[model samples]
Target chain A: MLRLCSENIHSFFASESPDEHEPPMPRSLTSANMTGRAPGHTTGKERILTSAMLLFARTPYSDTSLRDIATAAGVDVAYVHRAFGSKAEIFRQALLTLGPLDDIAAGEPDGATMISRICDLAFLRNPNRVEDVRPLHLLIQSSLCGEARAIIAQFIDSSLALPLSRAFGHADAGKAHFALSLLSGFVTHRAVLGPADLLAIPEAVQQRMLQTALMNAMLDRSDPGIQGQIN
Target chain B: MLRLCSENIHSFFASESPDEHEPPMPRSLTSANMTGRAPGHTTGKERILTSAMLLFARTPYSDTSLRDIATAAGVDVAYVHRAFGSKAEIFRQALLTLGPLDDIAAGEPDGATMISRICDLAFLRNPNRVEDVRPLHLLIQSSLCGEARAIIAQFIDSSLALPLSRAFGHADAGKAHFALSLLSGFVTHRAVLGPADLLAIPEAVQQRMLQTALMNAMLDRSDPGIQGQIN
Candidate 1:
């Protein structure tokens, strides 16, 4: 239901500048400079975040540690703290590294094209960066039981819900939420479900289903009489 | 994508029978009490699982601990281990308690009403059961990164892809997988994205989109246009 500009969406997918080839790393923490401090380099924080993102994506959060991130980034533990107050802060930054929100904001007005473009971009981006996404999942799981749940929920709410609502022209909040929910569900299912299971559904049929859902949400704004009925 | 029986779908929305009114505990586990464990005498393991499920649903998985589950279930640490062996197993059993799969499986054929009934059933079930669903989400997240991911993937395969393929009489593995993916995406979206998002698009429009896609898939069988196009 979010209204994205086609150009923006296209940019997200196509505008892969060479700099974006690899995630931003903390250059200051490179092996050559093993010392905790990075003189006059803002990238010190970026490096910590990049390392955290990689680890979170590949490993479960519970299994990952601050030490592991520090070692991987070639930075001292204290430096990590100085750059980002906590693992959570590092994670928050790492997630935003993809810059979906900024992308959406920059590309607007061409809502229909934008939505499709964004989807294509996401599909291409392999949103599931094991080091980053995996830990985020762990954090999400932890939020359900731990004190951090609120923070995680807030992140999801803002990152997903806020931008989505704005894109959809501030239409019915409930409906926008539902649309977002459906999109998230699809992405999650794709990531979690196996190739075998995925292979079960015919490619043609899958494509049709996805196309139909997206088109309907984007193009057909009128009531079609089958809304609640079709499920 | 999956073919659910009408009766089962109906039952999912209907309240429990008056005679069956008891705690939310699964009957299978409760009835397992033997000479040592009485009908009312819940095992420490069961308690741990129950507590874990509640916590998992309400909290995120990473935040939860054996200690939290034990404390809530009124059991000790050892008991938690004696019963499920690990946090993963406990989480798995807790999900089985929700009975979504069982409910879907139990539905009888009623082609005209099946889809609507299934959707209704899903919508009727509260997605806010944080305690119940949180662990499941954790399991799903963890599975993406570990061995258990395969198991979870298989479960999804059997529950959604297999049944739908059988119903459609499609031998083509790829086709079936695609269909399952779409359905899974839809369901996930509904659950995670709030109703608000769904309600954004006119109800009629949503219905038409779904109907078009479903009808096209059924009729064409081969070419459901727009393989990668956004619906």
Candidate 2:
């Protein structure tokens, strides 16, 4: 895929100011953005990105075109084309900005810790990501273009699957890929289908089953069921 | 939730001729359409529908306009609006046309049978249905319009979840809904992510784990793991 190569790619996904209503400070560090900045402060590119991410989050990619993003950002379409390169590039940035996976990756890289953290997040809320700017929903709603698929696949393979496989020494890549895919499916199901009532089983049991499934898949444990089977 | 209410709703989903390329015959029974027909023959509405279904299958719903369908169907835009009522309605019709779930429901409707049939279909092919017309892909690609969501949720509730709950007498509806949601996730993951190399574990063990996850979810079995635990 041709690179979009935003001139400020390094700062393109910097943390937003606590003001929350303003466009994110694309050029500044998080500590600088968070402290003593007025709520109205922003740059043109930050404005464009905020509008683009919000619009992309709210509507399917097919529904929100370059023109729409520009209109929402108060810029013209040509500027958007020049700056973001393509809608797919804009989406890739939004996903990086919104996802928690980076946080997990930046923390402990243990296989069980990774699986348990994801499971904890999965059931902790009801219809959680559907109403928000979530990476899972963003990826789900985006059109399956080569650029976008390649971007997501590369991210998952590098971020989640690779770390997971390394955590289980000498584990072939296939099991890690399958484990992440199943976990993705589990999350996608909730994000796309919205919420259903809680299952008849105790919530703890449900979480254990999910955690066990992922661990068993990820670690290739010989245990017939859960890698950490409930006693 | 106004329906486009095509008068031939029953026949709208009738099985197509194995001839494979022509518009399905709307007026005749499937046996007749399969037995004998000139390769090019089709009804005006059938031609319109065939065009609409193919376009919807190929492109995300937001990108494919009613005018686009009209052009492909060789009809005026007004005629499409007159016939299908709206883009969402057209997609609803298209989903019903492509789905295999109706076939399962039309068969014995056994609980494990329903779950296994879907699982088998999920893994039996590689990157299956991403390149072709499929109900799951259509739903995923379609914008999350209220009418489309309602149509799908209603169908799942009536066809799969309800019957599944019934299979295990005294079961709560919550368990069945959760079970189907997870299964939907499993299928959705495969459809959207394309494919990966098979898991390092034996295929049989993977299937057993998946089956156990779903059966345990659906039946609310008290056993710690796989309702039918592997020996």
Candidate 3:
């Protein structure tokens, strides 16, 4: 029975059909660096990562299993274990395939430019035309978990908070933390909440709303109302 | 086999020990109004609703079964089916118990007052001591699903957007939407992401951060750069 299930999974991946069973391979996985080899040789690993990314994006880590990823990728459960070592490793590798976070870690960021870059990395469709790049979505959900949560917190502190603190010469990095909060809030809304309703509002108006929120959050303007009573 | 499983489920809920097996009865369920009578008279339905809420909060709809709720509530599967009619109805009723959305639909809202109310309804620890209210968490997860997503979206529109439009005297209710965005973001971060790490920051600093974000999002102050460009 297990062998039968494994074969079914393998066939599903090899066919690469845009079926209900498989999330079609994302464009990012097709890139040279992400796949790490020619498509002919790394097809199995590539397919597994693509499926892993899709599942992780929408589902919480605790609920997702190696078998589920393997089944989605059309491979055996053993194949998944052999390839990725563990579920955590699969998730971490999947996250790395999403666009770079280096810019957030170092250098000065312009308000408009930073907003555009963050939005693009988050909302831009992969080459396969899939929207809501799954790894970023998964990262938000992963924040609730253990090791993954620690990794994400560290990433935010090192990549975002520290850079913003240095960029504007503020002794405090609260602005960067707020900036992350704004970006995270926007993306979470965009992904989990169906964007169809938001689309009813004029696109320009909504974009301006986000831009304003991001700028305000990134700049350290204190409100007197919350000062002394905050603690 | 199924009967044996059902019996085991019944024992689990009936014992009602503070084991991981059961989500302790929420105060809302214990209330005279919500459960339809005194606790002794309506233990079965109340337990079912409590179990349903916890399951629905974390598990996806399709993934959650009547059997699971029955098991968690210490009732027979038939009892759950007979009492609730369908899984969807049980979910809807569970949502109703969270508290009224009438305030969001129509009223003059003070931002701080409204924020406090929302935080209470969403984050309040039930008598059972579960800090994360399952329904709110489930609502966030439900956004990725179908009918549940529609219900949540309508709730936001009726409860939040319309009222905020009236409160602020803006023909556009986008501010209310933004306010919901901020609140949702905060709650999700608080619930799914552990608060222990955040506690490392000074209490005043974190509270000030949320207050500032809420204020900026609720007030429709367009940035100068994005002003003319906004539709």
Candidate 4:
């Protein structure tokens, strides 16, 4: 409860940083290099977030812990609590470094561009971009716990939903909100759930379906019968 | 691990029951009414599941304990442990009483019937059917924990997904799987997450939008422009 109030209080002063409005830099440069410390050094919080991003990617939220984050970050566990409050708070901070929300579907005029941006986050098996997708991976992995879902919901509400809503340029935020919600569902369904036949589709065709389905979600006002549109 | 294998072994002997193929009854008739043991005299396991279903609906998985379930069901905690193995296993058992997979979006020839089946599950606040939606509520509530998600995924694969796939009568199960995936995402998005403006849209209009968008997910082959086709 204190954590929730404190965060609200801080954000009141933290004017939406100009950095957020700027297109996100390549993640590698953004995370460690731009800590504004000595180039080789990271703030203890940054290191903890970096370690957390990794450990969370590898395990479920239940299995990952402050001790694990501290061990990975080479910091004291007490310091992690003092600074971050709880695992969920650390997760929120980590979500901040996960590039721009616009990188996923916001600000894209077309489906092809949208897919290109997010392929790194959830769909593709790009080893180099694995870090970019860990937040999503962790979301899917931790989706079964109430607290984790609450934190994620809070993050989406306060952070992800509005930017995408604004980026969609709709007076009504419903389109972007529903679209992203649908996207998360598609990812969860395909990644962890069954009906193995979906995996059997040629990856290329599935990508087309994903693009088309999402576009439909955004513009749900479409006539229902006209089918077979691909970006 | 032992629980998993035991389940698999039992399912192998348990030929698909005729009860599965029959259309599901209303929620009131399905859960306690058809326990097959007796009308008012539910078995200890049934009572335990009954309590679990209610308790899990109210709290997250981590917060809902074996002791809580025992107290609610009027049984000893040891019985819950001995019978259910763990909280997750009990959850799995409770998921079974959640009517049928077809109750969501399956076997129906059109979108109108599809909506009716599931309006009871997650979309409506139909108080009489609150018990029916408990499985989805629990799935959403516990979605933040890895163990909980794993079990849900397992349950989805083993029980829910294929039935819907078969019901859709598609040689390709991708459509059904993807549709259900999209549905869960929508529910999670609108319910737990935000873009609160959506709630402002009259509920009746929201229902129509849901039906249209879900149909689109199942039929992603549509020309992107043919929009606004409501079921």
The candidate scoring highest on lDDT is 4
lDDT of 1 by residue, B1-231 (tens): 001111211122123242332222223434432225666776666666667755654443444677888888887788788777887677666665543344344444332133332233332322233222322343332333333445556555655445544444554444444433444444444333223445466644554444443323322322223334334
Best by DockQ: 4
lDDT of each residue in B1-231, candidate 4, tens digit only? 100000111121123343433323345534343456546777888888778877665455666789999999999999999998998788877776654453454335344455335433435231122343445666655544345666776666545455555544554456666666777777766664444666676655665666666566555546534222210
- Tens-digit per-residue lDDT, A135-225, candidate 4: 5655655544345666776666545455554444654566656667777777766654434667777666766666666666655655534
Model 2 error, position A23 (Å): 22
Clashing pairs in 2: none
Error of 4 at A101 (Å): 4.4
Residue A16 miss distance in model 4 (angstroms): 36
Clashing pairs in 3: A9-A74, A10-A74, B104-B159
Flag the better candidate by lDDT, 1 or 2. 2
Off by over 4 Å in 4: A1-28, A31-48, A59-67, A75-92, A101-112, A124-135, A138-159, A225-231, B1-25, B28-49, B59-70, B75-93, B101-112, B124-134, B141-160, B224-231
State the lDDT of candidate 3 residue by residue for A47-82, as single tens digits. Answer: 898788777654556557898999999999998999
Residue B52, model 2, lDDT: 70
What lDDT tens digits, residue by residue, belong to model 2 across residues B6-114?
Answer: 1211121222232443221122322222225565676656667667766654455555788998899899999989988988787776655554345444445556665
- DockQ-best of 1 and 4: 4
Distance from true location, Cα of A16 in model 2, Å = 20
Look at candidate 1 and tell me the lDDT of residue A17.
45
